[model samples]
Target: MEDPYEILGVKRDASTEEIRSAYRKLAKLHHPDLNPGKKEAEDRFKAVSAAYDLLSDPEKRGRFDRGEIDASGQERPPERQFYRDFGEGPGGQKYRAGAHFDQEDLSSIFEQAFRQRGGPGAGGHRSFNMRGADAHYGLSVSFLDAASGAKRRLTLPDGQMLDVNIPAGLQSGQVLRLAGKGMPGYGDGEAGDALIEITVEPHAFFERDGNNVRLILPVTLKEAVLGAKVEVPTVKGPVHLTIPPNSTSGTKLRLKGRGIRGADQYVELKVALPTEEEIELETFLKNWEPKHPFDPRKHMRGR
Candidate 1:
């Protein structure tokens, strides 16, 4: 596998936001849906996703930087230490290079250590049964899917497919644990869990606030002036929203229980005029006389 930084075209010292931005651009360009039936694009997309999976994690990134792990996220062998690497003990005793040790000697050394703490191997033989380490993974989901609750199948770097259930109103940085889905355990111990971190892609039209949803809906000038029921989009689907008469830009309307879970959706109305000029409308406005003429910037006058 290529270095994650090089794969994402980011420098080693790049900021988190910079790395994320690069990955997003590459992911979009090589996404399978955007390039259907193109094997090259699909491969590139997978590589980009994998690279992001490693670099986006702080612990993994630090380990990789310290040479404790590889680009593929696998652990590297620890550097070997010899007698010369050790210093003198409290009694000025130095480690002897010619000294030999066997499995029984190591077990007895551990036995004494456990005996002091009254651990499992204090009185009996050492079991040495240990649980495996937990596995970490990353998954990306659409905004609607995250808000509405959906199931996704994640492909791990090892080519394993794992089913993931995203709960409704799931926030970013939340982890999902799959029991016994991690690395194999030693001896008779059980396996560890699989920790999956989710990243929700931003929607082009909707913004999330807590569990609530926000949107800026464009209404025609006539509709704003005369009032009408228009189809508005929600995370679930489109619903009819009533625009009050004389509605103007920045007028906020609430759709109860239309957001993620039981939260509400806020729609701000923006009155949009005709793209082409209307001679009749222009003439009417020119001769229009307002019954109540008030300063539009009255608040600005005092300041």
Candidate 2:
């Protein structure tokens, strides 16, 4: 794995704001929604996020810098460093791999290993000094609820209920962390955090386009032929839109600030021909013909 500082483009001693700014900038640039189907960007985004997670936490960062843990957050085993020391016995005695020893290093390792394994030591007592594992949960939310913010009460597996705050403009699959709400800590350790992955339900009429909302509006033949004002559905509610005269199908109109975060809601017009069978309308259409020969697709040469 690349160094966390290099991935975040910050110095090892960077300030909190500097680290935060770097992370935010990179996150926005490499967000999956912004760069869809970009595998390289997605991979980099994951790496960057992991790096930020490690560096952002003061304790983890300290451990990483001090060589106590690896970049992947796994605790480094001290056996290798102490192997040479424990290889030789007190009087230059050589102990091969898997060989038992009674040296100080071997005794320390055995004591810690036995304690972790829940085995009673010479004192015939089990002791635990560790933090509890973080808990994970899932939450379902509506598209609008994700666009706008909402609060929900969720019951965890442990029967603990937590009030989750859904942030505005949060994307699907994003996690909402509730600190100290996970499994209780061991002994006097701090409680683990609760991580809730947000699942935003798809909307029926509205489609998400980055920060914008997209919708298809059907217009009548007369409305398309001549300019008309029509009501269009938006997240904020229905609003009147002015369609230009002689507007063709696939014409788009932008309703400014109608989407989340002040994004414009784009409406594409689809001209629908009338299906009502009226003798008067048929007779009028037969009598009224184009003044000149016109072909809408005259420029097309081949399919």
Candidate 3:
């Protein structure tokens, strides 16, 4: 495995915040959801995550720096051992390979011969059960999908498919766990889980505030001046909204229970004028005079 520092593109003496920032930047770039169907990017994302995992842990980082553990976080074998079990023994009895022997005895002999090999299976140890490592993945969903709940099939890096169920009102950065979807276990142990981190994509016109939805609704000048009922969009669907007469830009209105989880939807009205020149309207405005003069900027001046 490549060095964690090199993978994250950080200096050996980088601070925690610096490492975190680097990881975040790389993660954002190589996130699988952002680079769909790109195997290289997905692999890079996994490597970055693993690197950050090792460096973020103080104990692991210290061990790695001290040469006690490798870049993969596995312990390094000692340089020398007291006894050499592979070659000639003290009495000149040699252990030769490819020689037929009892299954139990061969297992014991191999374990003893390779005692320096680290982890559960080595070191002359008896058979043991070990749970598999959990697999991590990133998934991206649309804002509406997250708000309304939906089912999506995710294609893993290994080409395996998993159906993910997104719950209603699911927020960004939420995690969903799939049991037994990770690597295989050892010696009858249970398989690990697959942890999928969800990222919610932003909408062009809609914004979320907690459970409530916010939208900037553009209205014509005539519609704003004379009350009109317009069809507005909500998480559930499009609904008619009543616009009050003489409403100006920045006017706010609310639609009850139109947002995620029964939350309200707030619409801020923006009065938009016609793009082309309106000869009649311009002439009317020039000749028209209000009975009550109003200063729109009065509140901003001294109040």
Candidate 4:
């Protein structure tokens, strides 16, 4: 493990926004999907994620900066105690252990150390143990898939296929927790949880604002003037929309419950004229005028 700031390529005094920006840049560059079959990139992505997790947490970052904890968020042992237990021997020689380190046994030892040193709790009586590392996965969903909710499959680091049920109205950056699906536990501890982040792809014609979906629909000049039923696209499917007679180019129409749940759908009118017949239409309208031909911009003229 390395310093989180170093891992994220940020200064120790970097602002929250700067930290987040750096993390996002690094994460995207090293994401497994972007670097398929590249183990090094995957590892870097994990490191970047871990760094962001610690730095994003105010309490953890403060503790880390104050030397109260190590880069892995583990409590740092007292200088004197650490030296007494695992310091180098005379002549700069290191001591070798006879047996292999058992993870469960090591966890128990660390737990005992925490209890003895009054970790987390104020008093030394409370027992505290570290949870297994949390796992993170990025999920990509289509606009309709996000709106309608869908089941998605993710390949985890352990080569396991995890099925995630995305709920309706899910937004980008929303995290879904899958309990006991992360790193394996040590001793009798429970497994860590998985954190899946949502990323909805951009739609070709629809845009999301909060839970609302907005669309710009093109209508012919005749359709706008005469009023007609035109097909409009929605999250569900294409449906017929009525264009009111004399509707303006910027007029807005509403389709209730057609967007993501908890929001409404808005359709903005974009009146499109037939370019090929423009000359003929202009010539025909040369002598024609509106019955109430008032200057719409009259009020804007300077006195």
Candidate 5:
């Protein structure tokens, strides 16, 4: 894989928001739905997703920046190390055996140390192989992304960038499992998995109600009273909706299939009065009396 920052088209010091913004733009452009049967687009999409997976994470990004890991999130062979980082030792001590000792030599040394302490199993032989512990993590997605489906990159604790598939209509606080994304297994043992919890962020202009998207649309008082064909916003786009004559605020209008698949968008009308700048309107209203005697608030208290 290419350098993660290069793949995401971001600087090494880019913020999390910048990384996410780049990922969303690239992923949307090359989404399989937009380009069918195109291998190159699919490949680039995957690469971009993988890159975002690494650079979006602070820990993995730091590791990559410090040269402890590569773009693929694999740990580089240490320049120098001792066995204590991986396991226990006598007197909880540290060693500087370095590259001078081979794997077999280290195993022999550990075996001798264990034998000196009378190892656990029968005949004083300790169990050498054990599976690593599973890890847990959290991932956040946008409201639209959660509703429309998306692919995201998660950074594992060990500096791995994992590609996560988010299903459409995914709710908040959901759990996703990634096999072998957790801690590395011990000798001859299988690596553990990672469990990721999903968090969905709130939208500024859209509210989700089951399969529907609710939006409040404001219109001029003239448009509401005289009735007009006005453009209303939906998740997909804006559409012209006819307002019936004498329609008041709190009126509901539905646009079918404009939300999630098989879902609708519900628009609520809010009639806005003219501001002080429109003095003519205030004068006309002061001199003109209602031709039709109707009490809209007759049902309210103190009417």
Candidate 6:
């Protein structure tokens, strides 16, 4: 294994927060869900995971820093050996070479050799029980799907289809964990979980701010000057809205419970005029002037 600092792209004297930030960045980048069927990215993900596993543990990190263990967790002396043998049978039949010991046999051998030294198998040789590997997946959702809460079908690594319920207001980068949905267990141990990361697509006309949805509505000059009932667009549908008499160009109007998840939000109205017809409208405006014209810049002359 390579150095944890190098894998995370941090300096050796980096703080815990810096290391954690780097790890999160790399984890999101090389995650298997983002890069499927890419062996290079998978290898990089494994390397990052291994580095984080070691550095996040205080005891293991101390031992590694003291040179007591190498990057792969082997002891300094590396107390492991391999032997091969080939011999002819009694009836002149040649025998092919093969591995001779299973995991249990190796465990027994190690237990006998290091029982007094308090190794991992000091308390007699026992069968290993390990959890399955955790699975990762990425899910893409539409803007409405994220806001309204929808159900989706997710296929597991073992060819199992799962029904996933996406919660309301689901944002990008949010992770959902499904228990016992990963690889199969080795023995009686439980299976690992499956993690799903969400990626919400951008909407053309709507934007979310916290739990509310924002939109810009365009209104004609006549609608702004004289009170009128006009149709306005909402996430649900279009509805009739009443514009106040003599409303300003930048007036904001509120449509209760029409935003995401029936949340309260406001729609800003911008008054627009037809540039080609402005000359004809100016002649009408000159003939019909209000008796009391309100000057918006009355209080700014002295300041």
Return the top candidate by lDDT. Answer: 3
How would you order the candidates by TM-score, starting with the best? Answer: 4, 3, 1, 6, 2, 5
What is the RMSD of candidate 5? Answer: 10.7
Clashes within 3 Å, all models in order: 0, 1, 0, 0, 0, 0
Cα lDDT tens digits for candidate 3, 42-131:
899878877876787687799899988898766575323323544565498765556456899666655653543433554444554556
Per residue, candidate 6 scores C-alpha lDDT tens digits across 165-232 of: 99988998798988997556765668977777787888877788877888777788888888789887
Query: Considering summed lDDT, which 10 consecutive residues are worst modelled in model 3?
Result: 77-86
Q: On a 0 to 1 TM-score scale, where does candidate 5 land against the true structure?
A: 0.55
How well is each residue in 176-228 modelled by candidate 5, as lDDT tens digits? Answer: 87887766776666886776768789988899998788998888888888999
lDDT of 6 at 7: 91
lDDT of 6 at 284: 88
Give me the runs in candidate 4 sitting further than 4 Å from their true place: 73-76, 81-129, 157-159, 277-279
- Tens-place lDDT digits, model 1, residues 1-303: 688899999999999989877876887787666676788887888778767767877877899999878987665644333233344554988766665668996666556544543457456455555567566566789999999999998765445678999999987878899999876776687997888878898999999999999999999999999999999999989999999998989999999999999999999999888999799999999999989897868889869
Which run of 10 residues does model 2 get worst, by summed lDDT?
A: 152-161
TM-score list, all predictions? 0.67, 0.59, 0.74, 0.77, 0.55, 0.61
Off by over 4 Å in 2: 1-127
Alpha-carbon runs more than 4 Å astray in model 6: 1-109, 112-125, 133-140, 152-163, 199-202, 275-277, 286-288, 299-303
Angstrom error of the Cα, residue 249, model 5: value is 0.8
lDDT of 2 by residue, 1-303 (tens): 688899989999998769867876786677665676787877777677667767877888898998877876666776665676467777887767777555975667767765654656665555665565455455678988888789988754333468999877898869888898865776677887877767788988889999999998889878998889999888777899999998988999999999988888999999987787878878998898877868889789586
Write the residue-wise lDDT of candidate 4 on 20-95 in tens digits. Answer: 7787678778877778899998788878877877787788889899898888767687655544565566697664
Which regions of candidate 3 are displaced past 4 Å? 11-46, 49-69, 73-75, 78-125
Please state the error at residue 131 of candidate 4 in Å.
2.1
